[model samples]
Target: MKNWIKHIVLGLNYLKSKNLIHRDVKPQNMLVANNVIFKLCDFGICGTLKDSISSTHLGSMRYLPPERLGNICSYGTRSDMWALGMSLLEVSQGYLPLSSESIMSFMSHMKNDWQPDIPTTLSQQTRDLISILLERDVNQRPRYYNDILSMSSMTTLEQNPSEDERNLIENILKSLPIPTPE
Candidate 1:
């Protein structure tokens, strides 16, 4: 998980430096290469940031941040952080975090500042990162990938996945269904 997060942060940092916003950031949009390297793909809805804000509302509804839903113009890299947080939460817990039956309920939950309960099984560093990434206030959330990369929670992490993590990843990859050409 830490390795995955590191690669994603690097990708986001590059995009941020280019003034680009990858509007869609979900598990499906992430690709694994050689069963090791992680990459973000499907930039169909990517947009350019103007004055640190992106006005267009285009992204998967489930992955979008509350600010984009409430006010399209009131979003930037902070919105991407929210989506990234949701993705991390899903990956960590093996399930999607939010499950509102209807859009109205989801909107209500967002307006109410609903946040996923961080699973205690995760490391303290991972939990802290998730909490900060999912902060309700956009201003409080990390606006750039560096903001997260520079955190003490992230600073102590190893740059590469450990042997145990590599084994676990290998096992998970081996268990996945192979795609059959259409």
Candidate 2:
């Protein structure tokens, strides 16, 4: 999972460097191949950063950033970062942070001050990283999440957690909408 996050960030870096923004990012768009490497897919809504016409609602409603939903102003690479954060949370916890059945329900769930209730089992570093990525205030969100993930502390995942711990983590991961390749 740690390496998965790293590769996702690396993918984002490559996209950003090329002045492109993938307006949509979620677990469905991520494909883990060969039981090891992770690849990002779905570029139907991709657009150049400088394109104002591309600022419209072209991405998944659930994965979009707050600014894009409520405001008319254009977004930058940070918007994609927000989606990345949401995806990271899902991949880490094996479930989406928010769920709604209808459009109205979805909008209602995205209150201005809303924050996802993160699980208690996550390490402090992972929690902090997700919080930073899911920050409602766009300015407060990390400008470069890859830097945060590359931190030594963030990479210190247990090589061999106890059987109980391993089972618990596996259970969480199995609950995700996307199946983990075996």
Candidate 3:
């Protein structure tokens, strides 16, 4: 999970440096190989950043940040950070964090004080990182990928997946049905 986060942040850094915003930053768009390397794909909805905000709405409903939900007219990397936080939460808990049945309910839930009950097994560092990433106020979120990756705790994590995590990832991968070419 730690390595996965690092790889993702690295990818985000690269994309952001190029003035490209990956509007869709979710677990589904990420590929993990042998629980070692991670690659981000699916840039179909990506946009070029003139300053830092994009007014267009183009990302998964489940993974979008509150700002992207029209709480504001525009959003930037902070929006992607929110999705990354959700993706990490899903990975840690083995399920999507939010239970809202629709967009309206989801936005309502986000507007209120909504916090994921992170498993106790996860480290405090991980929790801290997610907390900042999931901050309701975009201003509080890490502005750039490196802002997150530069954390000492994040950089010091071991580059290994425990047996349970490996098994869980393998099972999830196996259960996903591959689509045939058209």
Candidate 4:
């Protein structure tokens, strides 16, 4: 988990340095290899950082930041941090942190202060990181990727997904249908 977060932070830093923002940052777009390497994928919705904070409500509904709903608020790196927090929760709990049948329902939940219950097993550092990442007010969240990377208690990818678990994941991925490019 620590390793995954580290890689994500690195990737986010790279994007920020390039003046880019990945409008969509979710588990589906994150790839893990050897249970230690984290790779950020899917740049389809990525846009210039300067233009990211504009009148746009783009990104996967499940991972959409609170500011992107209804109000003409602009988003920035904090949006991705929200998604990252969600992804981390999903990984730790083996399910989505938020539950809703539709985007509207999800947004409603967010508006109502429906934050995920912190897991009992998570370390204090991890918990702190999540709390910051999932803050309702984007301004209250960590402003830079280094803020997340600096934590000493972060878990590395090597600590998660035992070898057998990875094999099962490999099999599952192999069973999925591949979408050919048009």
lDDT of 1 by residue, 1-182 (tens): 77788888889788878988888888888877764678999988888989877777788877777777777455588888999999989877767766634877877787676877999988888998889888887789886788788877667777667775587568667878999999
**Model 3 shows how many backbone clashes?**
0
Clashing pairs in 3: none
TM-score of 1: 0.88
State, as a TM-score between 0 and 1, how close model 2 is to the true structure: 0.77
Candidate with best lDDT: 3
lDDT, candidate 4, at 107: 84
**Model 4 global lDDT (CA atoms, 0 to 1):** 0.75
RMSD (Å) of each candidate, 1 decimal: 2.1, 4.7, 2.3, 3.8
Clash-forming residue pairs, model 4:
2-155, 3-155, 3-156, 3-157
lDDT of 2 at 30: 77
lDDT of each: 0.80, 0.70, 0.82, 0.75
How far does residue 84 in candidate 1 sit from its true spot (Å)?
0.6
Better of 1 and 3 by lDDT: 3
TM-score of 3: 0.88
Summarize candidate 3's per-residue lDDT along 1-182 as a digit string, tens digits. 67788889999889998999898988889988874678999999998887887767788888887766665747588899999999989888878876535767877777666776777888898888888888888899998788888898777867786565577678878879999999
Between prediction 1 and prediction 4, which has the larger TM-score?
1
TM-score of each: 0.88, 0.77, 0.88, 0.81
The digit string of per-residue lDDT tens for model 2 on 1-182 reads: 55566667778778877877778888788776534456789988888866422465678888878887776446667777788888878766667765634765665566465686766777676677778788888778767656766677547745444454445446656766896899
Between candidates 1 and 2, name the one with more favorable lDDT.
1
- Displacement of residue 39 (Cα, Å) in model 1 is 1.0
Candidate 1 lDDT score at position 28: 82
